[model samples]
Target chain A: MAHIVFEQVTKQYDNGFVAVKDLNLEIGDDEFLVLVGPSGCGKTTSLRMLAGLESISRGSLYIDGQRVNEKSPRERDIAMVFQSYALYPHMSVFENMAFGLQLQGTAKPEIQQRVQAAAAQLGIEELLDRKPKQLSGGQRQRVAVGRAIVRDPSAFLMDEPLSNLDAKLRVQARAELTKLHKKLGTTFIYVTHDQVEAMTMGSRIAVMNQGILQQVDTPQNLYEHPNNMFVAGFMGSPAMNFFEATLTQTGEQMVIDAGALQLPVPEEVRSRYQSLLGTPLIFGIRPENIYNPEFAPPGINPVAIEATVSVVEMMGHEEIVYFALGDGHEFLARVDPRSRFTPGESVSVSFDMNRFHLFDKASEHVLVS
Target chain B: MQDASNIMRLLGAIAAIIVGSGGIIALFYVANLVVNRLPPRPRSQILPWVYMVPALVMLGAFLVLPTLRTILLSFMDRRSQGWVGLDNYIFAFTNADMLIAFRNNVLWLVLVTGVSVGLGLVIAVLVDRVKYEPLAKALIFLPMAISFVGASVIWRFMYAYQPPGTDQIGLLNAIAVALGYEPIGWLVNKSVNNFALIAIMIWLQTGFAMVLLSSAVKGIPKDVIEAARIDGASEFQIFWRITIPMISSTIVVVSTTIIVLVLKVFDIVFVMTGGNLDTDVIASRMIKEMFNFRNFGRGSAIAVVLLLAVIPVMVTNIRRFQQQEANR
Candidate 1:
């Protein structure tokens, strides 16, 4: 078990391109921390710095409180599973898993025992003698994981290990990896650009953009209380919708004036934005927060607005409806599938007043998170 | 009578043409018919050899027969009149000039193969990471395009000697004279002539070795090397454990090819020094014995020795290829 820390770590290439900047992250022992971002977002660079694969340009890294900035990867005592499942093509599966142990000069009997236990754990016992090319992609993925397991290192670093598998196999492998993490209770730091994988597997997800950390929080917390516009839009599928609007105080309540529609904020949450009463702000709402009036759940403080339904997607349990307002502002809502809303029909949708988010227009930071 | 004889010759020509082309077709047709009439088990057993007959016949006539004749002549007199029974072999092994040839062949085998492959592997690894890799590889591999005799001629000018004289024209002598040292005769000096000849062969072959080895080095995936580093392998360990084994097959191919080429080394020695001044090798000596001295028995004996030396290298290479195919 290991607690890994990146203290203001920065990576700058020789050509003056900064791949990662001022990354500060603390991963506790036995925690499955996922570094999630889009392509070229520096998540992989940060992970590589921690793995000692890439050099840390400006700041220090610590593993169990040891400064390992100058240490080589071999001295770091961490194992990584590459996205390609980089098994040695010339070696048998057994030898592939035993390679690290052999390098460390582990006893023959112990190496054999550890390798067998790992293979049995991964349910790949029958594939011990087969070469890497002889195995299917999913089997190779397991062998890559099994190779890391045999090392019994303090941490496991996985760089998009499931991205190469087919869709169905990726889902299956995702669950198996989570179960394995829980069984081993080792610190797992996984890097991927897939948000769904991040949400499903990470104990806590760290989101990054443009070489900077945007937010680090639990999956539920990140969805319910995102810190900025990027996080709110990035975390959920179909994304959160935003409207350019102004907030005004009316008597004792606050109202959002979004040009096309106006809705009063809930009395309980009104005081959170009273100081910015007449300032232009951005209003945000997730797809799930908007609902069809007929099937809107009770006690959500629903405020009704009229719009024309442009398209409807029936998803068995719910419908994803695209709505266009009178001012041409468009948004989507996940409503109850039983409500038969169709295209070209005027429908009244309810916005949960308590769940709406307000952000400062200039900074795009949450005004009332 | 003349017209009658001409008519008869034309008829005979027609008969010969018919027998030549039609005979082969008819023979194959009848053999196919006979094989089709047999049971399936015997038919399957006989079919492959039937298909192999033409190639096997050609090999037997061209290769097998000549080799047997050469062996037979090795035991006979110079004119192949009577059985001399190992006298030529005794002369080949015991002669003073033949001993020098044997020693020089061994030197070529060891030094030329080792230096060429070693230099090729080192250059391949270092050049792969550079930005101007293609240009650098092209420059290094350009020497392979030159034939051995052409390369020897180029080096001959480089090694030309000018007897401690005024304004030496040879490149080496000019450098020595410019440095205030006496001009040295490179080819005439027995000590340096063999080495000079070997250097020419190395120059021609290192490029061939480099092209093969560079591709082999590049064939290893980058991730495998990175994984080795993360698995706690030092750089040296990674090279030994991952890089070497990954390119072992290519290395074997390059080495055996160089060995075969080095064993039959004749062109450079013949072009540069004509095997004089203690620079004789097996192939050049065999040629001299056969053509210049008209000693067929001694030449055949030397040829048998060269064949014996090369057989194991070829056999090992074939086995390696078969193993790789089986794995695939």
Candidate 2:
């Protein structure tokens, strides 16, 4: 319903501890934007400041083109689902959802109608008479969402609403929440420390670390085109392998001179990175990009490197082959399920240089996004 | 003679209750007849109060009648022959000994309630999850098992003082002597003795406050408070609007309980100081005026004043209980 804009927003505590710093993000209207990071990464602080729960120490926040820096939370017309679900323990589930509407002085009949409708929508019609203590955790979370939905706010601010649920329930609730967001068509700003949740839920994720914004991009873009070393290493499982290598001009092509092996820079990106020739850079590649020479994709322009397989994790669909080059830097390659490579076996692993990632040695900033 | 009158009063009270119930049933029948003029549902609401007539009548006899009689007696002459109007009240408030009693009662009310509740809250918050929390709480709560008269008697010996040159017999004075200080007279010193008695009340009542408030404090989940903050409640707003409302019944129960007990405080003062050397309080003063001096008018006035002081707190406690029931 509303596009949220954070223009250099900073949240510094009164004790001079900065929770969030110089955040500049534009969340599109009706977008499910997830702010994901480790604990103390300021994702929750950013969400809190957006909800007007915490004050923005600097900069401004615009919701639907209105600067809401000085507005109280009630004045901002946003509904929030807390990690604890924050139901009025004294009230019945019906009254718990009706509370905000009641506080706004909505008519009793209208409040009842909306609450009943929301409860029915959430499949909690039977729970309407129950107090929060009488319900299970998943039911409480559903009621929390139902409470937010009943108000029909301009946006929904969720601060780790699913983290308290058990793993299976969290997964089920994640899909339910996505469906709810689509049904409401309201902007959903969710904050969490779970990367998997962020990847599964967010239309666009803003990754933060130590009070600093690291990257803001789609899940696919974040995995494919990380803007810095931190983002590249943080997004993928079995994370991208890195090596300290220098770029060199070799007979009409550019290649990285690793200590004991030479990795060719792909022709498509060689010219683009020619200016950094002979300069030290970090060579990076995803585990999925490396394949056994025999199992390499038909047209991937694979560069073969001889390495000994140190470990092989057979994942049914594919094999995760842990191998090491002569210089002793270990790497993981996701090869075909049919691969017969075993530990201590020398195999030719193919690097798909088309998906190569590079970062500046000193700055750790990505050479290409 | 006292036992004979007590039995006679018991027979009189039974006869009054029988007559009272009959009168209440008659009153309710008439009220029901009048309310029957209204619509059925509205009459239904009003009819419940008709069912309460028995209770109201009993309250009128046992509570309201005695309160009215006390007020009436507060204005009468000592011999119950002529009206003295405000003379008894004036004497109750203006007399030197009576003023000292009022001052001492005020000191008891302020210090006893504040220290007990304050220390109770501190201990409750700090003792949770400690290694021997139940043992510690039980130890602190043990004083409540002792009757006020017994507690005062025990504390009286503890506060016993001797001259500096003599070996101290009391625990406090003995400690002082061992610590190489002069053995000060704890009970004989007016200011010190009043506080000494006040400390016993605090020691006795703090357990009551702790047992109730601690449970209330424990009932508040951390996440709920966080939710309030996110729900737009400021820290102060959360404390005042949410936290206070959630535990208000407990707070009211504890406060009014201690307030009512302080209003009628007599046993401790009588046992420890015998209403002497600036230790006189309203209830003790009333008893002394009525018995030792045989000044019934002044004593009735003091009793009336104490009843007046306790009424609001009692009403508040009843209201809190009613509100809690309403919520349920």
Candidate 3:
């Protein structure tokens, strides 16, 4: 097991398209670092550079302190699981697992032993003689992982390994992959466009967009404290709601005056926005952070926003009430499932001011507390 | 209704029978007059008939009738005026030139087919992933565009002989002269002249093999290749272990095709040496016996032997193609 470091690494294709720009990351040993982005956002390209499939156009990469920028994939001692699963379609499961060992010139009996062991670990021992095409999607994915596991490489680079599986199987495989990572205790750099996979699977996620690294943090930290508007908008489901509001001082209390509504800001928010008092700022709040009046804590300064309910999505455990502000701005508020809110009805929703995020409208940077 | 009427009318016509029968008979005449003079059809269904009529007539006259006649001639004496009852077969078995030609044909079949296909496979794999791959393939495929007679003429110039005192203008001799070596008679040296003619056939046919095998090489899925690479297979291991196995069927098809072509090869040998100097293949010798010497019986025996030699390979090729289609 080894830590992987991408130090100012960049990848420029032969056609002069810059796929990854100055990517610098350090994944510690046994850490599952996920590179998450939308499609063509340089996540897979960065993972390929780490896997040594694509050449590093600028700067160097290191695995356990060894500079491997110019090394072939085999020489770098890394195992990769492709998004396609890429099992040798012609070989049996056992032969597929034994292929790498055989190439390394390992003894025949030893190769068999390792292959069987990896097969057993994957619970595919009965499928040892079956071709990849004969296996189901999940089994093929496991075989791909088994192929990498048998190598006992310094690190595992997976490029959206579970993307091909059906929804139920993807969930099952996600848990199994975490278990496998725990069991192997090897660095895994998984690239995926699915943010849920990144949040659930990665020990730390590096979210990227347009070939630029936006934010990298633990899943919880990233969710709670996204550094900028892009991160704030990208990380959460139903995304953070944003509205233009002026941070004004009203009788020594900082108040946010969004058109047709005004609310006293929390003391912590006031101090955070002290420098930007009377300046226009973007107010961001997650749907889950906003609630109905019954759940609002007493003595906590809550901002009451008047909105007309446009739609109510009745999820089993919670209700998502989409409301339109008078000025035509729309936002969703997660409320108790029993709340009887109807469309076209005006309601006052409590926005927990302490939990809301404020960003400088000009720079789009979060105004930190 | 009109289409059906027209088809029926065409099929039932008195002129159809006369024209068809005359076409068949005229194909046997030396001139190829009526066969080449057929008119083009306005419609596609009629077009197939227009093209197939000439081929059918030609096959009936040259291949079908001649094969039957050769079978009859095989049982006759040299003069064909008298029946000799397996006398020609006995003659073919005992005759030294006929036996030598048969043996040399077998050697040519093995060497030319095996070497050309093997070299083609190597060339296909080597240049398959090169940066200038199209350019390289075009260069290799260049020799295939040259007709067999043209290739023979080109090689003849290279193998041209000059006495020691005379100027060495031939390519091989000039190269030898440049290297300060004595000029050798490349085509008249009987021990190596067979190989020289075989080289021309190989040169002409290797390009066909390369083009076929190159397509097969490209047909291997990129995923399978990348999978093998990720399995830690070296480039050489991938080529041998993965690539060769994947394209094995194509290789067999190409090899059998070249073998069939080799069995029928006559132009290179005939043009280069006129089947002289220990270089007579079965087809060339059969032509020489029939046309030059007018020995129908011996020529028929050689023709039957060549047919027999080719039938099994053709059968195998057909079966392989059927199996490949079934697999698809």
Candidate 4:
């Protein structure tokens, strides 16, 4: 197993389109590094470049500190699991898993042992003689993974491997993949557009957008401290709400004037935004942080904002109330499921001031403590 | 009102059928009278006459009677009314010219069909990945548009001989002269005439093979190729191992098609060489014996042999087609 490093690697296509721009990442040995982003965000392109399927336009790629910019995929000793499960349809599962070893001229007995071991580990021992067409989607995916496993390469590159399966199968395979990674103890560089997969599986997640890496951190840290507005908005479901607010200092107290309501800033938040006093700032908050007045924690400052509920979506565990503040500003708040609220009802929602995130209005950079 | 109209339409249909049947019966009666006057019936107890009538009539008119007449004419002294058995077959199998024709035909079958299909497969695989593949294929397939006779005429000028002196008008002789060499006769040389004719047949057939194999190559799934590449197999190995096996049925079908054409090749050989200078194939020899020399029995024997040679290949082709369909 080896640590794979991309040292300011860049990929520019012949058509003059930049796919990845100065991507610098160091994936440590035996670590699971996930590259996550929306579609066309260059995550897959970066993975392909590391696999040597795509040519690196500039900068060096190193595996175990050896520069592999000029190496072929086979020469790099890396195996990839494609999104389509690109299995050899004509070959049985045994041959599919044994192909790379056979190409390397491994002895027949050794190939058999390795292939059988991989099949057993993948729980596909009974499926060794079956063709890929005879297997289900999940089974084919496992066979694809097994094909990579028998090689025992320095790193495993998976490009959205579980994206083709149904949701339940994807979830099961996700857990199984994590277990397999731990068992094998090899560095894995996985690429997917699914945020949840990255959040749940990776040792560290690299969020990318528009061919640029936005943030790289642990999933919990990413959730709590996104670096910019895009990362903040992209990382969450029922995403963080943003409102244009004016920061003002009145009598040694800092307050933000949201158009239809004025909210006094708590001391901790005030200190965090002390550098941006008197400057306009954007206030962001997660839906779960906004609560009904009865559920507000004691001794915490609550910024109560009154707005008419425009729509209420009753999820089984909670209710999401879409409320319209004046001047066409709208946001949602997750509240208790049993809360009595309806569309056209004016309700007082309290924002937990401790959880609110403040960002510079012009730069969109988070105003951090 | 609807019943009255339906009855009138039914009467009109019955009237038309009666008129058609009346005309057919009149014609059959006249034909029967004419047939009865020509021959008396043989009394056979076990053989059913009615069942054999239509088949006998057709065979006599088209095949059996014509064969008998040809055999008779082959034995007779050219006017035809005597009997001789095995004489025409003996003359056909023994003649030196006939032996040369047979040799030339075998050479044509092996060289023309073999080289064209081989070259076609290589070209198909090479250009399958090229940009503007459709345009390349159309250019290659353009020659198939020229009729065999037309192609023969076109190449005749190309193979035209111009001896040692004077400005060469033929394209090939011009190149020879320009290269400071004596222009040799391409089609008239006994040693090279067969090759020249084979070249014409190859020109006509390679396009057919390319079109067939190209479609077969395209039908191989992209994922299979990617899988083979990711397996660390080189490009050449992938071609031989994955591509050839996948398109084996198409190769068989195309090879059989060219074989059939090779067996019946006549137009290019006849138009270019007129069975002269060691260029005679089976079809050309059949034409020479039957029409040019009026050797009917020998020609018919050659025709039968050619048919016998082609039947097995045709049967295999049909079975291969059925197997392909069943696979689908």
Candidate 5:
């Protein structure tokens, strides 16, 4: 087991295109740290670098407090599972799992025993003799994991290992991977572009964008308190909506001038910016934080605003109502299924002021991180 | 009576070849059985090499030992007694007749090997996804089925020349006359005769190259290529480190095949040009020295040079094949 640390690690291609930049992350031993981003966001590059597969263009990487910039993948004692599984086409499943051990010069009988043990753990003992082409996507994925497990390496690096499987199989594999991580008790640096996978599997998720590290935090922390406009917009489905407005401090109330609507800021947030008035700022609120005014529970003071319902999607348990604000800016509100809302109808919505995010217009950094 | 005697000679030659080949194979099989019967029972991998003993032995007897003897004999006089030093080699390099043969062989090697492999690669890539590829490949490959002598005879008729006027009997001169040009002797022109000879070689070897390279290209998987890069391989490293190793056996097979074939090629040049008018290759020159001029020293000297040239390429090919098999 190893604790991996990336101290300002960066990956830059020969053409001066930086895939990752100034990434400082510490993954503790036995911790599952996921690197998540969209395509071309350097998640896989970071993972491959950790696996000693890509050279660090700048900065240093440490595994268990030992600098390993010059170490090869074999010397690093790490096992990797590629997105396609990358099983040697000529080898049987058993041979595929035994290849690393054989390369390491592990004894023949021991290689077979470890391979069989891994295969049995994966419920693929009968598949040992079959080639990768004969197996289904999930089966191939398990073989890839088994190949890593058989190595008993210091860490396991997986690059979107479940992406090839179908939706149902992906869910099943995701659960199995989490269980595997716990059982092995080895550090796993998983890379994927799926936010759901990062949130569900990673004990800590590191969000990245355009070669820059955005945030490294727990899923609940990322959802509740985002650090910037990008993080606030990227964390949740339906995305957080942003509107340009100016904060104005009146005698006792801080009212937001949102073009055609005026909403009061909660007193606690108002006190933080009482001295600064008439400054333009970006207001962000998650879809779930806004509710149908009629169904919004009584007890706390709510900021009421009017909007024209554009579309209503019934999602079994809740209805996501897309609405256009008076100034033509659009956003969504997740309302109770019992609420009666339809397209082309104007409805009053209440923003949960306590749950909204505020950001500076110029810097785009969250004002309340 | 002469015909009966000739038939008997022919039968004897055929029988000798059959018995020689069968005896070598049986000898290797018995050796393999003996090795299998020995103690310390876990060396099964020696079995393949044991099976390889027949080919190795044949190569040693007919090719390697003869090459070594020729190199040794190249330093001696025709009687194989006096030390001639580099006399035969000097005659080979400086003599105008031998120089012409040397230049012609160079032309044949460059044109035949280069063009055959280049054109074969192009054709293989083009027909890779075509619907009637196998039919096209088979049709193109038909030349290989005909012996080089047979092909030379066929193309000889195609290039058959006649006198300027009286009925151009040859197909080429007939076409020339039809196209309103004077009849021309195709093989008599020193400037173009080498090319004409080289064309027959390229035609016969291109199909072999195409079949081997095509299969090698198809065997490479995209996943393995990407995995190679992900496993710390750069572009050139990926090419040399993974791609080459994967397809190396095919490359060595095709290249050595063409190289060895070209080194000893004589049937086409002998049949078509009779090794005259700048069309004489090393093989033809060697035969002319040994059989026609009765200069065994010169012929063996040329044979030694050819063998030496081919040995390096064969050694490199053997090493690559060994590496590939080891990885497997």
Candidate 6:
């Protein structure tokens, strides 16, 4: 119901620690924008500032085009689910859900009806009279959510709401929250350190590091094209592998020379590297993009290289093979499980040249042609 | 012969010490042995009570027997030689001095309990947010370490009075003289004397209430308060709706404790004014009746009244504790 904007939002504590540095994010109405980062990355601080729980030190915040920097949380009409659930332990589940309505002076019957509706929506109708201490963790989590939804606020700000649940329940709750967001169609600004939750639930994930907003993009876009070394390494499991290499012109071809192995640039992209010849660069490739020569995918601009297998992890779907070059540069490859490979075996592997990435060695920014 | 008799006395004293302690152990050991030989079902049923025998016997002899004797003596004459029926009870309820004591006791109960707990809770909430919280709390709680008699003695000097023409030595009279007002006798003025005594008791009991209530307030989770704020509760609303209800159990505990203490308030009245000038309370009057007047039946009747007054408060406390246990 509200489109929240953070214009140069910065959170500087009294101890001189800047938690969030000039973060500017635009969350559209009904958008599920997740602020994701590692711990101490200021994601929760950002959400709290939006919820009016924390004061914005140096920025203007707007909800539906109206500046709300000075407004209290009640005036902002935002409901929040805390990481600890924060349900009133003394109140029964029904009373917990009815509290906000009662405070707003909503009629008693309407309060009861709305609470009942939210409880039914959460499939927690039987738990109305039970206190928070009497419920299981999952039930308490639902009650927290139900308490927020009963108020029907402009937006719902959840700070890692599912983190307390067990892994299986967390996954189930993740899907339920996504469905709830869609059903409610209210803007949700969720804060979590979990990459999987951000990738799965967020319409757009804003990745942050060291109080700086690194990138804000869709999950697929972030996976396919990260802006810098941190994003590239942080996005995928087992991470993308990097090699310190130099782009050298070997007559008609530009070959990346890393001393251990040399990879010839495919002719289609060779012209883009001609001007950068004799310059140092960092070459990167995803684990899934590397393959055993015998199981290499067709239509790839393949460049063959040789290495020794240092370790083999036999995952049922695929094997994660660790390879070491002659110069002792090691990298992981996700290859076909059926490929016969073992530790200490010399093998030929093919790199999908079309999928490789190059970055400036000094700046670490991805090179674009 | 004197040396020999001294050695014998020493030997007898050591033997008595050992025998007394050993006798208690042997009694419990023999009881456990006897219970063990019974059928398993009956043994299980009777084992706990067997262990409780010493305590129960002591309670019966010291508590139950005295209470029964007091009740019995209440219905007899001054010498406890003939039945007087309701004469002593009527005197307890209708006598002019006893009436003043009852009124004073009620005033103490309401004002002392109300002000101490209310002030304690308010101070607790305020200090919780201050930077020097521990220091402030320690200072506020220091008075609780003083016994009721000691606190009353301290306040006696505080409320000390002198004639207007004389140099004022008491803190209150000194302040009044500095302000150019005539020095007033705080404990002798019948209209305000009970209030003066009650203030001293409040000064002593407030600290006890504050310490307990402060801990209860600290036990409330921080995030819960934050959630309430986000749920549209103002600072005042949060205190009333969230804080008060959250620490209500502790409030009940502190209230009943202060109430019981107030009901048996004697030391302040006794030490400050000796129940003169309309400062008499139930406990102080009971003491005077039993020891000074030496009226056995009337004293017993007043003692029974004080016990009856305290029973309801104790019952409520027990019921609350039981409910808490059942919830757990």
Candidate No. with top TM-score:
6
What's model 2's lDDT at A267? 75
Clashing pairs in model 5, backbone N/Cα/C closer than 3 A:
none
Fnat scores for every prediction: 0.85, 0.25, 0.42, 0.33, 0.17, 0.82
Can you write out model 4's per-residue Cα lDDT over A75-131, one digit (the tens) per residue?
888888989888876679998899889988999999999999999999999999999
- Candidate 6's residue-wise lDDT over A1-369, tens digit each? 999999999999999999999999999999999888889999999999998889999989999999999999999999999999999988999999999999999999999999999999999999999999999999999999999999999999999999999999999999999999999999998999888899999999899988889989999998788888778887788789999989988678778887886988888778787777877888899999998978887888778889999999999899999999999899999999999698999988999988988888898888841
Q: Give me the displacement of residue B85 in model 6, in angstroms.
A: 4.7
> Each prediction's TM-score against the native?
0.81, 0.64, 0.85, 0.80, 0.61, 0.87
For residue B327, what is the lDDT in candidate 6? 74
lDDT of candidate 6 at residue A147, scale 0 to 100: 94
DockQ of all candidate complexes: 0.63, 0.18, 0.38, 0.29, 0.12, 0.68
lDDT of each: 0.92, 0.86, 0.85, 0.85, 0.83, 0.91
Chain B TM-score for all candidates, comma-separated: 0.84, 0.77, 0.81, 0.77, 0.76, 0.92
lDDT of 3 by residue, A1-369 (tens): 897888998889999999999988889999999999889999988987887678999988998899999887778788889888888766898888988899999999999899889989999999999988789999999999999999898889899999999999999999999999999999998999888999999999999988888889999999899988888888888788888988888678877777766768777546656788767788888998787887665765577788899999999798998999898889998888878789999988888776778888898888862
By descending TM-score, how would the candidates be arranged? 6, 3, 1, 4, 2, 5
Residue range with the least summed lDDT across 10 consecutive positions in model 3 chain A: A294-303
RMSD of each: 7.5, 17.0, 8.0, 10.5, 19.2, 4.2
Better of 4 and 6 by TM-score: 6
Ranking by DockQ: 6, 1, 3, 4, 2, 5
Which is the leading candidate under DockQ?
6
What's the residue-level lDDT of A158 in candidate 2? 94
Candidate 2 C-alpha lDDT tens digits along B82-145: 7999999999889999899889889988998888887886677667657798998999899999
lDDT of 5 by residue, A164-222 (tens): 89999999899999999999999998999888899899999899988889999988898
Residue-wise C-alpha lDDT for candidate 4, range B178-246, written one tens digit per residue? 998888788888878889889988888888899999898898886567656666777787788778888
CAPRI level of candidate 1: medium
Off by over 4 Å in 6: A243-249, A252-262, A274-282, A292-296, A302-330, A333-350, A360-363, B1-87, B176-182, B325-328
Q: Count of backbone clashes for each model?
A: 0, 0, 0, 0, 0, 0
